[model samples]
Target: MLASGLQQPAHGMEAEENPYLEIVKRNAFDLTNTPTNTQQKAPEPLKANDIKLTGIYLRNGVERAAIALIEKDKKNTKPTYLQLAVGEKQGTVEI
Candidate 1:
């Protein structure tokens, strides 16, 4: 003869009861302190026509990346000192 499955010990374990399920609350934290970030614009290469390299000198053994430059907008009269580095929109450019 065929035998049936066991249904005698089905209610053996107990279920857990949460106490704070009725009084749940949340708060919106202030985010004004967080700094806003923006993507940097691609830097355009220094136009050869607009800028003229005045001089390049080595200072001792240290890095001498600082070069004298003058933009055409100023009639090339004022020499604006600049460094030979990548110029980014977010970064300060020496003048």
Candidate 2:
């Protein structure tokens, strides 16, 4: 029997005589020949704030120890300066 160009040979016929085999073969060929969809491009990076900064301080003297405690209380949230000079103005130190 033949329907829609597909052949179904009699039960005793050889496999090479079946028309359905041709249809299946053609479908397999088309499936392998078809192309896949293209991939999408990646988006560009925007200029945004993504950087972070952290600070840590250690001191041994009594005056430096007091400043370190104050820094701890503030959580060292912002950049700060500490001074230890008694007679002369010393340079600022970042913590």
Candidate 3:
């Protein structure tokens, strides 16, 4: 009510226009225009001949068990490790 004792418009809430709706509505897409099956590059394969097991340490009463691996590549050599508790082994590495 505009300073008058008159009944308000239907519950006093009217549908308001959203300004951004026009922009988004114009950019709406359909399945026909949608892209699918994007090209994905395959990862470089790891060769088993290049991986070497350096050492295996079995756990003692208080000591931890660990397996050390060395991967030799043309760029650089890297060391990988797996640590385990007594009677535990990690999933086997193929290489």
Candidate 4:
């Protein structure tokens, strides 16, 4: 899956035969150079309104596992920014 994400436009070349070369060619610019514009841009900070609960259904076994992982992270000291809402009904939780 990671390989497919990094795969390059082969332009008809066989990917299986030379996957490494394909990755190198595709990421050459990103690997070798930095952006010419040096002006740094500050990322826009999230506002209070941006934090909200997102609902997702536990459809099957795989989805159940995914939800478990998300829920586990939510228990950490500095939890991830994502808010996971499970089950058939919708609800909200205060931070």
Candidate 4 on 2-63: residue-level lDDT in tens? 79578676655575576577777788567646667889899896432323234444654423
| lDDT, candidate 3, 18-88, per-residue tens | 45556656876643554687788898886643434444554465445455655545336556676655566
Ranking by lDDT: 3, 1, 4, 2
Alpha carbon lDDT of each predicted model: 0.48, 0.45, 0.54, 0.46
After superposing candidate 3, which stretches have Cα over 4 Å from the reference? Answer: 1-61, 72-75, 93-95
Which regions of candidate 4 deviate over 4 angstroms? Answer: 1-18, 28-32, 41-95
CA RMSD of all predictions: 17.0, 15.4, 14.7, 21.2
Clashes of each: 0, 2, 0, 0
lDDT: worst 10-residue window of model 4:
61-70
Ten contiguous residues with the weakest lDDT in model 2: 61-70
Q: Higher TM-score: candidate 2 or 3?
A: 3
TM-score of 2: 0.20
Per-residue lDDT tens digits for candidate 1, residues 1-95, read 44477434333242124334333323244345556776778999766424445555565653334555555567648666665533422123433
The superposed Cα distance between candidate 4 and the true structure at residue 78, in angstroms, equals 36
lDDT of 2 by residue, 1-95 (tens): 44876756557557768777888877865676546867778998653322223333344632321122124345546534443433433333222
Off by over 4 Å in 1: 1-49, 83-95
Query: Which sequence of candidate numbers ranks them by TM-score, best first?
Result: 3, 1, 2, 4
